[model samples]
Target: MDARAEHDSDTRAVSRAVSELARRTRFPIAFGGLAQGGAIHVSSIVGARTRSLDGLVVQETRGLGGRAFAEKRPRLALDYRTSRSITHDYDGQVLSEGIATLFAVPVLVSGRSRGVLYCGSWGQAGVGDVVARPAFAVAEELATELRVGEEVRRRLATMPPPATSDAMAPAMQEELRESFAELRSIASTVTDTAVRERLTKLEQRLAALSRPAGPAAEFDVRLSPRELDVLACAALGATNAEIAAELNLREGTVKSYLQSAMGKLEASTRHAAVAKARRAGILP
Candidate 1:
């Protein structure tokens, strides 16, 4: 999708998240923004006067959302109108909406803050952990989706355009094979299962695209999911113990996966297995 469409879709998801958070947290208003440049530009809001928050911008470290964005953590203010915990740069707009208590949850992806989610009450209702917990859950879900969306856009940008004629040029065909291999490797690092599955299917479709019109290669290199997971890390030069720690598996299990992958690739050593897999378009 183009940038505007992508942002529109993300805004819809953000709307649903804020609405649910407002319902669960008993907050009268919920609003938030994705990080852009040095500020968080509020993009979605619920239960608020649109003029008060619509398109509001919070500079880094200048407001509750700013503090949370800079610190990469949650920031809270009970009685925000009179609180000194955060800068009062946005107080006029916030007070216009009669908001008192506010919570800002930073949406983190791969340990970096990408956005903020705000839950607020018009009264000094004191939103405690009871509300913050579920609000953070929604933030986590948003972070996951944003990360996948980033990956999809980044990868697809480099993909070859549709063939004008019936045939793909030889150079483009080889590039597609390499990209398919990279996609499989990328899938191994994705924490979201559905995103990983989508990447796997993309890799398969690319593999099919690279084939001749007649029957393709009879030998389809089949590797188990675990095997792919283990080798993808090993290809990055991760040690067995490191791989085990990263994958949350026992050291023995890591070794077992390595051995299985080597056997399936018909390679006698771990390095050989990695090289063989790369040649077979099983690794980037």
Candidate 2:
């Protein structure tokens, strides 16, 4: 995809994510990608139509999402709309959404916090681990996808111009696709999310190399990269603990990502998720 098309895809991906998250967790979900001046700007949401969250500027360390991004970890408050745990910069929106409890998770990429992913309830103390897991998993997947896009652009920038028409030939495309498979094979041995994200980017870059570089394929639906990983392993008949060991996360965490993925895929079981993802071209 060209730069402009890629940018649009990223926008759609984030926008779609909030709605998908809201549906999956049955809680109001919101997302704010980091922008200049070190602030996260809320631009997309689901189940928050009552609030004017669009362009709601959240300064660093100023709100729940801010604290999560600043601390590079998940932050939670049982009664956010009136809680003293965080500043009230965006409480207007929260109150508008009728959120009495809330939680935020940082979208960390390459050791840097890129933004915040949040979900909350209209009642006090309404969220718990089972609800939070898929949300965090979705955040992780977005971080990974963004990091991959960045790396692809970086690598393309470093490459010299094409010397001839043969530069992007079909034969070369096949070779690049092979490299993608190899990278996935190597990445399975890695454990760290950040590191695996880099490899995933490399694989994505290779796959892109195999396709025409004119424009990105129209991808209207957003899928979690981390979800695909877990589901892909499950497709291979790996157990939850085994997937967790390979992904360098706790077994329960793996389950949450899987559940979130299943919701996104509209599947009721691991096998069903794998099948749906395959049909959706989110898996191979």
Candidate 3:
């Protein structure tokens, strides 16, 4: 698939998951991922627009999203109307839209907090713990899907684009450039460093794809999803212990994933694997 198409597909998947969850629950649901710049970027919204928060980004340690990312766990405010512990940078936005009850859960993959999922109510001021817990699980699934999507995109990058002689129209080419720029901007804001860096590279590749015809760029070594998962955790600067915790695997299993990733990348150490993966288009 084309880079643009891949991004659209990922977003669509997120939307579908969130929509399904929203339909089954009373509160509105929104799913988002961490951006490179350590900011939480909303990816999908599936509920009442009681607020114009479908695609909003919340900075680290600022609001509920920020707090969730900071604590690397679910953060909740029983009543948004009277939460004194959390910052209210986006409160006006919520208040204007009548979003009173709110719960935020950090999405984690490979021991790293990726982004946040939010479930909220417009009429009530308190969010039940029961709702918050299940919301976290759903967010975890969304995060996994994102990791899988990233892996697929990496694989697609390895499969060389079809041979063609014709160039795109100038207008279409410019549009691609604009789209790539926006994507890069989004990539830059992800809270996870590894995801952000990989996204940056992906953005660069897409930009290159938009350039006038040239020799196809060579791809580096590829990795399986499991290996990619391990490398992603390592790239996040997590130890095997941390990776194990994140993936719910034994530390030995984490080591095995790292070893396999290293072997694929022909790396001699964890650092080398991460470095080579980045160079090989495996780590982001």
Candidate 4:
């Protein structure tokens, strides 16, 4: 994808993250935007009661969201109107929305702040682990999406166009496999339905790109998501323990999934199972 497409994807990701934040934390309002020119330009909002948050631009260290961005961590103002720790730069917009309490979490990627997500309520609400954990998960999911996009774009830039022959270059095939595995890993961890669906589509595209230039192999087997995840990691030569750790499953569970996948593919070993999956277009 080009720079414009990448920007649009990033924006969509931020929008989804904000929506998920609102749903997960049960906040009355949620909004956020990606960093541009060293500031968070609010672009997406959910559950807002008015137009007060529209077009809101938050500068680093200037407000609640800004402080989160500057510190690369979450910040909260229990009483927005009388908060002494943060500047009231966006109070006109925030207060106008009747948000008495506010929380901000920065989308940190690669140790740098990429943007900020804000959740607010009409009344003061204590942000305990229940609320904070999901907020952090949403931010981390968005960060993972951003990081994956960057890696894919960088690899594509260095890669040559596909050849006319049926076979792909060994190095190009390896890169595609790596990207496919990474996308699967991310998809397994993502909770938002829309984001997960988008990742699934990307995974399909990568698999299609890596297929040989001929009629696709006709196969009737369907592997479950966890089975696919385990297979993808195995394709990268990861052992059962490594796949277990990466997928956050027990080693026995990973082995079970692998064995099930192997049976579905009628393969006697994990290596054979991976090869069969690739041939069946079940993997990249």
Maximum-lDDT candidate: 4
Clash-forming residue pairs, model 2? none
Task: Give the runs in model 3 whose Cα sits over 4 Å from its true position.
Answer: 1-3, 28-36, 49-51, 125-129, 155-284
lDDT of 3 by residue, 1-284 (tens): 78678667666655655664565455754545555487877777765555476557899888988998888887777778788989989877667667777777777766777677677777674556557555755676667557655654554454443435576555544444344433433343345444555555665565455444454335466666556666666765778897777666799987887888788777799998866655544333
Off by over 4 Å in 1: 5-13, 23-26, 49-51, 156-246, 254-284
Q: List the residue pairs that clash in candidate 1.
A: none
Tens-digit per-residue lDDT, 113-155, candidate 2: 8777778776775567677877876776677667656755654
Candidate 4 achieves a global lDDT of 0.89
Q: How close is candidate 3 to the true structure, as a TM-score?
A: 0.51
- The lDDT values for all models are 0.76, 0.68, 0.64, 0.89
Error of 1 at 282 (Å): 11
Off by over 4 Å in 2: 1-6, 166-284
Off by over 4 Å in 4: 165-167, 239-254
Tell me the tens digit of each residue's lDDT in model 4 across 1-284.
88799989899888888989999999889999988997899989999999999999999888999999999889999999999999999889999999999999999988999999999899999999989999999999999888878877876777665565767788888888887887788778767676677778878888988876677778799999999999999999999999999999999999999999999999999999988888888888
What's the number of clashes in each of the models?
0, 0, 11, 0
TM-score, model 1 to reference: 0.64
